[model samples]
Target: MSMDAPTFRVGVVVERRPSKSPWVDHAWRIVAIIPEAIGTEPGHVLGHDGEAVLLYAGARSVEFHRVETGNYRDNLTSGSPGLWVTLALTDEEPGIRLISVTADPAEGESLTEIGDLMVEIAPMPPEIAERLAAFVETHHVERVFTKRKRQ
Candidate 1:
């Protein structure tokens, strides 16, 4: 929440829809990544209008690091950059849990190695893009590539 810090908080919204799957009653997916969810509590149900349930899953921190600027730059520059959200669910649980929100594509993709968690890609909001771009502009260093000598 600090204006000058490398970290900021965002709201995670999830849509829970009744499922036709024989084993599961509902299916959930991230519907939005709100720039600021300062006052909302996690797991609060926003609305349910017969078909889908909208829940303010929680607020999560998207942090920036100098060393990861290159990755951030790559993410921001990509034609379709996204903010990755990771949600967790257990067999006995009724709703999914917000595990994390990340701007690094690779780091987020790596999280898919765990099959149980729901990993989704959401379009990066302008607010987040601005901050990410600023961080990259300030800290990203272009590493020079050198051809290897055939010894």
Candidate 2:
């Protein structure tokens, strides 16, 4: 979608435990699907992680925001796509929490550093990528180059 336009997907949160590696702890995976309508919530949570501390109760959905052209350019320069996923804890309950998906790497990094939370830059599924591209095509407006007048 456009940089300003936010795309949302309703999907179940899947938790994966570290099985093969000792360095890996636990991770929450976003298994999302395109919803028929906007504002639809996921039916339920998928998988379980006893080590993960729930920030909220019940199921959680994700909000994906397209990377703006400026950020995308920066990512290209830095050899990164700037795609990030953030897991935030809520004060309401202690069961599940909402996940925010973004294309801005800086924002995601800040959240993790400042909030002391876990954030991942996992690969987006093909279906989700296609949908995101569609959203960007529909909403993104090309930036026009304007020469500045020297004072």
Candidate 3:
């Protein structure tokens, strides 16, 4: 029940979308993630892990969502569209960082942004949040949840 356990290799990306879809569209890729080196911005380096990624393109930025994580499907299906993003890294691990990017949207997108980004490694009622935490733990990415408001 420790809160700081490492789990998945999480990361984030910034993509731009020309139009808005009724659903959060997986259209773009990771612009960056917390790199494995010092002085590097958290969640800013792309292609750290050799895994496939699915990104959703929005009006201003892109949301990089990983499909490899088993819990992704569950969280993505939940009605809650907003989620938190974090970076997970262990004390001993190096050159290996996990970035936690929620399956939610951000602000300024008018119809997209939803709620506040909650960052905690615990079981949340929403499968997506749990999935996000699991991914962070597995990859050791410390995450920061950003809350969104409805327009």
Model 1 agreement with the true structure over 4-78: per-residue lDDT tens digits: 448878998889899999988888888888866778777778898689989898888888877788888889889
TM-score of each: 0.87, 0.47, 0.20
Per-residue lDDT tens digits of candidate 2, residues 1-151? 4456555543334354344567444444544322333343433333345753321212323344444645444443464343466655444323235566565556767778756465767555555555555655665566789999999
lDDT of 3 by residue, 1-151 (tens): 2333323333344432332576433223334332224344533323423333323211122233443233443344555434344323233312223334444333213222334322322122344355565554464433468999999
| Candidates' RMSD to native | 2.6, 6.7, 15.6
Cα-based lDDT at residue 29, candidate 3: 30
Report the number of clashing residue pairs per model: 0, 3, 44
Candidate with better lDDT, 1 vs 3 = 1
lDDT of 3 at 59: 15
Worst 10 residues of 1 by lDDT: 1-10
Q: Which candidate is the best by lDDT?
A: 1
Q: Tell me model 2's lDDT, rounded to 2 decimals.
A: 0.48
lDDT values, one for every candidate: 0.85, 0.48, 0.35
